[model samples]
Target: MLPTLRSLMRQRELALHLLTPEDALPAGALDAAIEWVHSSDLDDPTPFLSAGQVLLSTGTQFEAAPGAESVFAYVQRLRDVGVAGLGFGTEVVRAGTPDALLDACLQIGLPLFEVPYRTPFIAVARAASDMAAEERFARRSWSLGAQRAIAIAALRPDGLSASLEELSRQLGHWVALFNANGALDRVFPAGALAASQPAGPAAAAGADGLVDTVRREATRLLRRGQRASSTITAGGETLTLQTLGRREQLRGVLALGGSSELDQAGNEVVTAVIALAGLALEQNHSLDRARGQIRAAVLRALRHGDLALATSVSDGLWGELPAEPVRCAVVETRGGQLDAVTEHLEALVVEHPGRLFFAVDDGRLVLCLGEDGLPLLTELCSAFALRAGLSEPGAYSDLDRAMAQAEQALARAGDAVGVSEFGEIARDGVLSYLTTTDAGAIGRSVLQPLSEHDAAQHSELLRTLRLWLEQNGQLDATAQLLGVHRHTVRARIAQIEKLLGRDLSGFQERAELWAALLVAAE
Candidate 1:
């Protein structure tokens, strides 16, 4: 401990005289502080003394600026410059401490000591200087000891947690280590205010917002080899957050979690923790990837089939199967190439955070979306389209369909337009014939009579009848889709029925004609 002004004066039996009581001096109030500076400048004590050093001044500096600031202001200026305490001379300055200065010192938490006329300024300076030298030696010794402990922790096979715990205990803080995936792998409860499972995916607010801020900043630093510190809120309490990354191939994170900023020892522990965790994550990428893939596969299997099957494939595989009925989406890029599609897919996931099943095939992204996945997928498709022209959405499906049906629909949509045919093509071969068959042949076969009639009359009777059938005979909806009034739509349907010599209202007739419409659309 550095020698305080009151403590030193007592060693010389001077605390009794200097701290005489009527306005009794508190314990250790009269001793000369070891870390103090001589400051005669009343204008700005900052120019004279560095931060954290006590200031000693005479009344002459304040006399020059008496026109403006009071002695209170003068004391405040010195304190603002990191002055620990200030001493005033009784001989050259006011006979007694000024009430204004006294109030300022007490209010601002700055310590003030009296310099009696009989006391020599040189003696006080000499006393403080000697104590400072001794204090410096102790500080170096403590720092060296801490550094050695950290070095030893670095060499341990499993010493990261131990080193951090010890460091936090020494420095008075909390410590947590996070893996690359943002999970807390270790936590030592040195200063944590709440009891939470820190290793879980969810973390609560900590001291100075340390919990949330540390986890977030730690993950970021570990990933990019960057460092950050901030104040955060956790459990309705404020806390300090400090994050550091290791210098290794797979850098990890060390988090100093507490209500106060970490001291030097705490920082070193943070560094050591980062080194161990980062190295572990970096070295275990292959294993991590494999485990992640397995988990994903299990989740994937759960999507279309039984959970048991997904669970049986591999541990952690298929862990994230999307909830059903999964929505399918197609993405088309500029060049018709599948390359770089995965990157865009990943980016899409990041931009729209939710459950999504995205896979790249050829030049497209086939995503089996989670809840609201279709709309998100649409937005993603639009973004990809804006970036480059290779992305597009083709064939689609019903709001509900079997997994097999949805998959087929996705396939057909990838190959053609309308987005609903992957299943239709497989079910009845209609989508395939309509999309892949020679359009002229199919059109001639289905719309030949219409061509002949239109050749004679000039009307879209075939198309009109097809629209009529699609509306399920609902005059209103079909009209809306066709952008015509109900009367116009009915008339078109009537005209189409008459031209084809069939009652379009009949279910069979409607079905067969709908089939032919697909063919004609080819």
Candidate 2:
């Protein structure tokens, strides 16, 4: 809030008159803070003048036939050095203001003022300095007030959201909060802030594209876990991204949009918000860990067939379990990537509002999800390339049995199939229980006689028997599948029954042959 050119002009006691037209001055130059003021008669005073200062000169050096070009060069140099404006002293050295300097100031868009001889140069400098000090003190006071307000908001019932709301008000910008996973958790000003252009179809499309780009950049910055700030131009507005947390443990990010770069006071407020947000995130994480421990205990109690204890613990943490049957799933990562899989599942669970209990046990992830969450759990497993086994839907009382079934199904899941269900394994019966070596042995033993017979006699009996079994021992259907007549199929089945010394009509024999066929195919 240092004194600006316009503010100095308003001080009648200083007798400052703007030589340059108000409209001709550079945009924001009048409102720009004047760091200090200095007087110099030396040519090329730019070396001594700093940025954001009003340079006062008596044109003493210009008395010696100073040309317009020289005046232009001097003003250009002062402008290049970021001098806030040029103040030419009148009624001394040279009467009134010279035409060359006035033209030069107008051409360069630099603010120029005339200081009457009645007003000493020291007066203007002292005034600017005093105003700057006053503004500094005011800003400091305002910053302290904002910080205290934000801190109090953080202690309110709504906590972080209230703090964010206060921050948005102080900043005059939209604020958005993102979780650790880079997902947007909340936004201040709600839906009022949108990325969009003024009008036209092309502008609309461009706005959409820019919004997507900003979101991608924000997410990337959050995941990178670096304390950084970036300005993104989107929808004709500037958006700034700021990471919240300590250097070692990045917990979340804050996105501020619809505003320009923050000033000193604004930056101080942002720092406070970042610190508070970090503490809030840390507290939330600690709470989540405690809840997870409670959930783990509940899972263990359920596994031990202690339903009442499990129910009590679960109710205390995540409310009541679903009244409907719930399915238990056991998931195992392919490459010992438990952390990645667990994070993925946890994110999915957050999206699903229903009750879910999950924890890592014995190097595998176990979950008892609500029946409605089955599809999402399945999707998460498949997306993460995790091998999973799911048990049938069962009540909380049947938790132990469901877990056992899920584990058995997980063991049955071979490399070919990524996921297996208890019902599928149960349907496979004893064949599903066989290991690779055992199934191979059983397959060779049951089919070796027919295979040898076919090899020795060059008959199609094995193929015919497989087709017949696959067709559920239907003569006409098997014949059609084999592209042969029903009579030929019947003859082949009779030869197979005689060669195996077993009646194909018996259910036990048919079951055994079917199992052998399945094992051999595998």
Number of the top TM-score candidate: 2
Clashes by residue pair, model 2:
none
> Tens digit of lDDT per residue, candidate 2, span 282-398?
887777677667767777777677888977766665556555588888887764355446656566655664656687666567888786777776786666667788999988778
TM-score of 1: 0.45
- Candidate number with greatest lDDT: 2
Error of 2 at 338 (Å): 8.5
Query: How many Å off is the CA of 48 in candidate 2?
Result: 1.2
The clash number for model 1 is: 49
Q: Global CA lDDT of candidate 2, please? A: 0.80
| Candidate 1 per-residue lDDT over residues 11-71, each given as its tens digit | 4623213323324443444443456657564556577687656566666655543533466
